[model samples]
Target chain A: MTEMPATEMPATRFPKEIAPWDVIELTIPVRTDLVVLARLTAATLASRVGFDVEEIEDLRLAVEELCLSLVRNGDDGRLRLRYTREGDDGIAIACTFEAAPGRGLRELPVDDLSIRILDALVDEHGRSSEGGHKRAWLRKRRSRTVA
Target chain B: MEQAFDISEREGTAAPVVSVSGEIDVATAPSLRNRLQARVAGGDTTVVVDLAHVSFLDSTALGVLVGALKRCREAGGDLRLVITEPRILKVFEITGLTEVFSIHPTVDEALEAPPR
Candidate 1:
C-alpha cells in the first residue's frame, strides 16, 4: 500500500470530555472518510497486534458497519467517537450521537443480515443508553487465525 | 464523490473479462447490471468481473450479481468474480455469495481458472 502523506489527512479534534485512548474520537468528522480511514486503521491495528489477513478483513467489515450505522442515524453536523483497549488483542470502539427518536440504537437491532455478519466478525458488540446519549460499542479482539 | 462505475473488456484465450470498479450503490447498480446484461446478450457467457477497486457493495449490487449469474447460466455462459479487496469480499460473504460464485484471489487467477 502507498503511504498516505500526513498532509493528505485532515487535522481533527475531539470534544474536551473524550478520553485520549479513543482513536476514532480524536478523529472526529470521521463520517465522509470512514471507508478509507476505517480500513486503514483496521489494517494498522491488525498489523500492530499480529492479526491474519482474514482477521484484518473482519475488522474492516465491523468498522464499515459501524460507520454505516452512524451515517444513517447520526446527527448531521458532527459525531463523536471513542475507543478503549479491553485486553490483549481486544479494543472497544464507541460512537456517540444526539439522543433522538431514530438516533436510538435500541431500535437499531442487529437482526439484519449485514449486522449478523458483523456480529460474527467481532468478539462482542452492543449498544447502551447513557441518559442523553446513545453509544454503539463493538469489541474487536485480534485473531491470529482467520477464523 | 467518485465514478459510479467503469467497465473494461478484454478478450482472453477462452473467455472475455469485464473489470468493474467503484461503488455499487443504489443509484449506480443499474448501470453495472446493464453492462453485464449487455455482455451476456452479446453471447459472451464466460465473463469475469474484476472488483478489486470497488469500495462498497450493497444489497442492490448483490441483486445485480445474482441476476447476472442467472442470465449467464441461462445463456450457457459462466460468471466469475475476481475480488482481492477485503471490503468488497466481505459484501460477497455477507450475502452468502462465496458459495454461489467462484471467487479468485487475483485477476490473473480468475482469468486462468477453467471455465464452468
Candidate 2:
C-alpha cells in the first residue's frame, strides 16, 4: 500500500498481509436518519464473524460514532463504508466521506467525546485524507476463546 | 424518515420515571435530553431513567445523560439510571461513567435510593 501523508496517517494504511474472506460495502446519504442502517450492518457483520455479544455491541457503537462524525463534518455527499473480514477472526471497517468543494479532507475532531468513545471500543483506529475525501478506519480482533 | 426512538414518562412514587426504548443516537438524543431537563425543571430532585429496553446507545446519548446528570445536580437534584443490558452497561464502563451516575439494576431500586 502507498504511504499517505503523515498528517493523514492511519486511514489509508491496511494490514501488511491480509487474506480476507468476506467484504461488505455500503454508500448512503449523509443524513442522521440513515445512521442506524450503518450501525445495524456493523452489528450483523460482527456477529456473523463470530464475535461475542460484547464485541458485537462494541462494533455497533463504534460504527455509529464513525458515521455520526462523517455526517457532522462531511459535505452533502454520500458516506461510504467497507467492512472486511480476514482469515477467521479479524474484522476491519473503513469509512470514507466526500469533502465539500474548497474544503479539503479535514481531520475529524479528536478532542470530541465521541472519538474518545470510539477509541475505547475498537482495538485500533486511524484517519487519512487523499484528494477531496477522508477516511476513518477501525480494526477489531475477535476473541480467541469465542471464535 | 421514521425515528426508531421513543420515550415515555410516568409518575413514580418518589420521582418521575422515564422509560426509553429503541436506539439513542445523534438524531434522537435531543429528545431524551429534553425529557430529562423537563423533569429537572419541574422541581423533581430525583429522577430514574430506565434503559433496560434500549437496544442501542451511542456516545451522543451518553453525553446527553452526563449533561442531564450535571443539570440535575446543579438544580439540587440528581439523576439515576436503571440499566441491565451488558451491552449498554459496557458503554458506561468503557466511558468510566459507571461511577459517575447512580446505577441500579431496576427502576424500583433506583427510585428507592436516597436522593443526592
Candidate 3:
C-alpha cells in the first residue's frame, strides 16, 4: 500500500458537548485498505444505537461511499470520521479532510452514482467546505420496527 | 500494493464465469475492473460474475461492474450476476441496479438462463 500521511486532529475541533457514550471518532490514513475500518466502525455504532440489520448495512455502505468520494477528490489527507448517536434512534456521521495543496474538495463529483447511492441510503446528507477542508455529513434514522 | 481482492475465471456450461471473493471497494476496484475488461477484451461475450463470497460491495465496485456490463453489451454480449448475500444485495437494490443487471441465485442458474 502507498504510504500516506495522517495527522490526528485535536478533540477540541468537535463540539464540546460530545458525550462519551454518544460519539466515536476515528482518524485513518486516506488509503483504500483502511476505508473498511471506517465502514465497520460506523456499522458497529449504528447497530449499537438500535439500527436494524438493513439500516446498519445502509450506514456501512454510506460511510464507505463518503470515504471513497473524499479519497478520489483529495490527493492527500487523512480521513477524519465522527459518528454520533442521535437522541434515541438516529445516527449522524461526519467525514472531513484537509486536502493537499491544489487538490480542494470542490472537485468532488457530487452528481455521480456514488453520491446517489449515499443519498438513497441515508435520511439526509449535506456538504460544506471551509479553509480548504471539506466535510460530508450523513444521518440515518432507525425504523421503529424492523420488518 | 498487492490487491485485496481476486478474480478467477472458468468456462461455464454456456458462458465464461468469473468468481470474485473479497471486499470490493475503492482500493480493490481497479483490479476488478482490469480483470473484467481483459475478459471482455478477449471476446468472451457472455460473462457471469459470481459474487456470493463478496462480504462487502461499494459504489466504486458497482460502477466497475456497470462499466463492464456496458462494454459487453456493446460488443453484442452480456454480463450476469450470481448474488445470494442480502447485505450485498441491499447495495444493488438501494442503487436500483437490481433491475439493471440480470441477477441469479447461483452460477448455474446464471449460465443456464436463456441468452439475452
Top model by lDDT, which number?
3
Error of 1 at B25 (Å): 9.1
Query: Could you tell me every candidate's TM-score relative to the true structure?
Result: 0.57, 0.84, 0.84
Count of clashing pairs, candidate 1: 0
Model 1 sits at an interface RMSD, in angstroms, of 4.4
Could you tell me the lDDT of residue A84 within candidate 2?
A: 83
The TM-score obtained by model 1 is 0.57
Taking the tens digit of each residue's C-alpha lDDT, what string does model 1 give over A27-119? 444344344565557566665656777777677667656554544423443445565544446565665655445543333433254455556
Question: Which pairs, if any, clash in model 1?
Answer: none
Q: What is the lDDT of residue A80 in candidate 3?
A: 91
CAPRI accuracy category, model 1: acceptable
| Model 3 agreement with the true structure over A1-147: per-residue lDDT tens digits | 111223232223234465787988899977777888898899889888788778887888898877766667236778899888776677788898766566555445553667678778887776666457777777888887644
What is the descending TM-score order? 3, 2, 1
lDDT (Cα, tens digit) per residue for candidate 2, span B6-106:
89998947879999998888778989999998888878777889998898888789889998999888888789999998888888887788989999999
- The global C-alpha lDDT for each of the candidates, from Candidate 1 onward, is 0.63, 0.78, 0.79
The model with the greatest TM-score is 3
Candidate 2, clashing residue pairs? none
| Residues B5-99 of candidate 3: C-alpha lDDT, one tens digit per residue | 67788974688889998788888888889989999999888899999989888888988999999999999988999999988887888778898
lDDT of 2 by residue, A1-147 (tens): 122222333442444455444788888877777888888889888888799888888898888877766556335777899888755676778888875456555554543656667778887776766566777778887875651
**Best-fitting candidate, scored by DockQ:** 3
